[model samples]
Target: MSDTSPPKPVLFRSYYRDWIEVYKKNAVRNVTLRKYLLTLSWVERLAPDLRLSELTRLDYQKLLNDFASEHERQTTMDFHHNIKGAILDAVEEGLLEKDPTRKAIIKGREPKSRKTKYLNHFELHKLLESLELSSTPSWDWLILLIAKTGMRFSEAIALTPKDFDFSKQTLSINKTLDYKTRTGFLPTKNKASIRKIQLDWQVLMQFSELTKPIEEDELIFGSLGKIFNSTANHNLERRCKKAGISVISMHGLRHTHASILLFAGVSIASVARRLGHASMTTTQKTYLHVIQELESKDIDLVMRAMSSLN
Candidate 1:
């Protein structure tokens, strides 16, 4: 005799709570987990009692639209992606008949305009000249290193004397500071971020002297304790004003470094590696405006060359 069993009814909220606890909590980093939790909070607020099998395409679209009403386009896209992942898993588990989030339209409010974040080469030189480097580790020293190396704030702050190779003229970036955990060391952002950036002789010499007295394992800039990015940015802005250049944040120095290299005709792949980017695509997207300007100059050169050939 055949026996029939009733199918279990899984609520979206219940399934999602289990999903995070079982899969996401251990699989993702703290930063990523925090974002997932925020998205989960939205789900709990909007559709707590909705059953997985009962959710329709329109329901999913409405969820995204409701969240997007307050967020920017990029942020809304992230929210949709986070929710869609859980829904797709439910589909795989036979909790739902089909994907409800297919072709969902993303909507969001307009983002605010911001001032330019990078300075031209001439302006960068002026800003660099204004920095007063000393044997003691200060923000000026940090600013100089960032302007020259294009390192992320955490990566720069995590540097120890041994990370620098004076003979090879290289600066190693194998780890980063975990400010969230207040841990002194953490893994780099990605595998690509674990790299040795080549340094100019002047910079190498300066740092070699600066680090000579410090222990190899001791952090160069650890005296500042926990770094506050906003406070550092404010200090950088003051330095720019004193130097009579356009004000930019601490991270903007990385942009300035990359922009100068790209303007000097460095390959995108090289710039991407120098910045420890995961791929050339990221470098291309970040510097699209600069790349476009370079393309225009290339067109002028092409015309001149063809005319001269005739």
Candidate 2:
């Protein structure tokens, strides 16, 4: 009689493919899906022959150590996080008798020096003053929009003439352009990202006239053919260098916007809303340094008031 027993398990890389296809492929954005696919490529490289049934804590630690040898700590942590989900699911499905990733120690190369992520208010003023705004929209307008509104690159690019409510002086951010793949409009980062940001009158007036002759549904900035994030960052860098200020990336403008708001005593909750962060915890973590400085000022104010009463 022919054998009818179940077949032995496949390699861990094969198992990961099945898991990602089932759990991730259609469930995430294209950008996120690419990250998961990149992780799979790494899995194939590091553990091509690792069997799901033969995985152990020691085996997993070795795998992580190998990946950590070249990557920084934070990147290794992300790699571990990406693969951990698949391993946990395998354990739940009885592919492994126990979790192999348990108690795995993460390791990586030393981090490089961090670049300045944001500018102080004075530096930002000089940068803004350096922009050559014209009657028509330009990348400078895009830069100004991000610096003023804290909108993501994708969000700002997706703006339409209709998205601006001239009467209310508000700009609606409900979607994002897939600039990476040029896949047209995609949903906002999350539910909280679908919001309207109130604009200052000067910005409101400039955009109102700029969009007046354009079709309601037309993109405000026009066609940005083959434009990448680096394109904008380079533009900003040149402008910064010209203005004799610290060079920062396009996203740095978003950071500058938030930092200025936090330093000016805007509530964390309000800043979170304006930045379209899913939660205040994210805002708190990102701007913790600014918050700490504000706390020091608050304590000094309290002491001065108390001394006055005495």
Candidate 3:
């Protein structure tokens, strides 16, 4: 017997949108909304073909497995991990009877290196050397801001003139750029991200001299009061490649700042506050391996010296 079935119809489930709206409305930081939005992108792509009534935990598991096969472990873990949070939210909102992502756990996602992958002092020098001759002031100054203050690219991009408090020696972070949204500044990732970071004299001096009649509503690095130049990230990457350095992502610069500070003996709590981590716990997790590695080296050195005495 021949069976004929029509292609399944695609539908945009309101339940997905509902959860997004709920998250956006009540989330502690716009960053939560942004993350949920990213996960929902995958759900949106897959959800259309899915019959809401028939969808089960097994379906999402298969989706995650498919993602794992297509990407490396870390990326796949991020994909499922992020979406699982959304599903958990659904459970909270009474949209689901049972959580589909109940046990979508990650095992080997911990930081693996003590080196804290960032451009070293030499690479930093090279990067600055490359930026010095830019046709625009924003280009060079933006790089300086990151190197000096260690602001995340998104956080830096979202900075408005108001965020810079010269009299107080503080920079307040409220928002950052989210690529998937293709929009203006959205709330940062967590409550702790909305922090006030104090600046060193060098950073303050450079900023004071850099902005000429800074407008309150204007973004710091933007030209003509725009949020960003749009091509900034790609252009910077291309510039790095031309400068004969391996093209590390702009985000790497942020990590580079933290690694340098940690190597210089800055306390983890200070680093967390400066970097706007939601919790010291998050900061610790990120650098725990680095601390362990440093501890091991110190122990080895001590053992060597003791043996010499013996």
Candidate 4:
């Protein structure tokens, strides 16, 4: 019998929804899934009726230009890549004659200049001294740990009493909290992020006393319950004000930790490992200014040593 059914028209939004359901949802983490959904929302807004066969390069460029108008260049790139992945998949499925996103120019406003998000050694010491850690677990404890360990907020929040090895003075980071999903014990950001951080004697003693009364499996900071990043930053800002130090976000403590270590002549590789960065490249890119400053000091030291030898 001859086929007589009409072919279903594939709208851009519909195909993207299907692609996300079948390929992206299970493959990505909840945080990543949320990002994909956000990008899909943009696609829906700009090209609701755009058919797969009718989507020209001009239409796709218009979408990118529209999104880039409000976002930073890096963000716009991420948005472009997300949509392009699905569009390429559609092409492979013979839904389109050619890719519409090819050679699309990225456009965006210039990023605003911002001050460094780390504290100096003296400022950090002042901030630490301000915290009252007398056998009680609070956000102060969390801040202290992050400042010393350079752990990500998610990794630090997910920690339990059992994660601390007092005898060995090591803290294991094998899991992360999914704040977006309000779930506990998700995998770390990357394989490299799963590491054991060595702890100072003082920190170990403080944590030992703090964790003594808590259950082995209970989170050190207890349940935060849907706390937003801005809220956390605001709290940290208050702490900084109380400490009489310049205000910095919670993540700034991580940066401060790494910066202090690098300034103290720690190897880039060791700093990268301690920070749980996926690669040295990531650490380098994040603290390029610090690295450049350190290079200048190294040049001066080399010249002094050479002159002294003569």
Per-residue lDDT of model 1, residues 64-95, tens digit only: 88888888988999998887888899889887
Candidate 4 whole-model C-alpha lDDT, 0 to 1: 0.89
Which parts of model 4 are misplaced by more than 4 Å? 1-8, 113-116, 223-228, 305-310
Q: Whose TM-score is higher: candidate 1's or candidate 4's?
A: 1
Task: Tell me which of candidates 3 and 4 scores higher on TM-score.
Answer: 4
Candidate 4 or 2, higher lDDT:
2
Error of 3 at 290 (Å): 3.8
TM-score: which is higher, 2 or 3?
2
Best by lDDT: 2
TM-score ranking, best first: 2, 1, 4, 3
- In the range 31-139, model 2's lDDT, one tens digit per residue, is 9888889999999999999988999999999999999998999899999999999999989998899988888899999999887899999999999999998877788
Global Cα RMSD, each model: 2.7, 1.6, 6.5, 2.3
Kindly list the per-residue Cα lDDT of model 4 for residues 205-291, writing each as its tens digit: 889998999899988887555656677788788889998888998889999999999999999999999988899999999999899
Please give the TM-score that candidate 1 achieves against the real structure. Answer: 0.93
lDDT of 1 at 218: 90
Candidate 2 vs candidate 4: which has greater TM-score? 2
Residues 1-310, model 3: lDDT tens digits: 8769885632324566665676565655555566667767766765556654354777777777665555566766777766665567666766567877767643333444443256767777788777663333476677677776777777887777778889999888888865445666677766778888888886786677666566778766666243343455566677677777756655667777877787777889999988888888887787786678778888999999999997
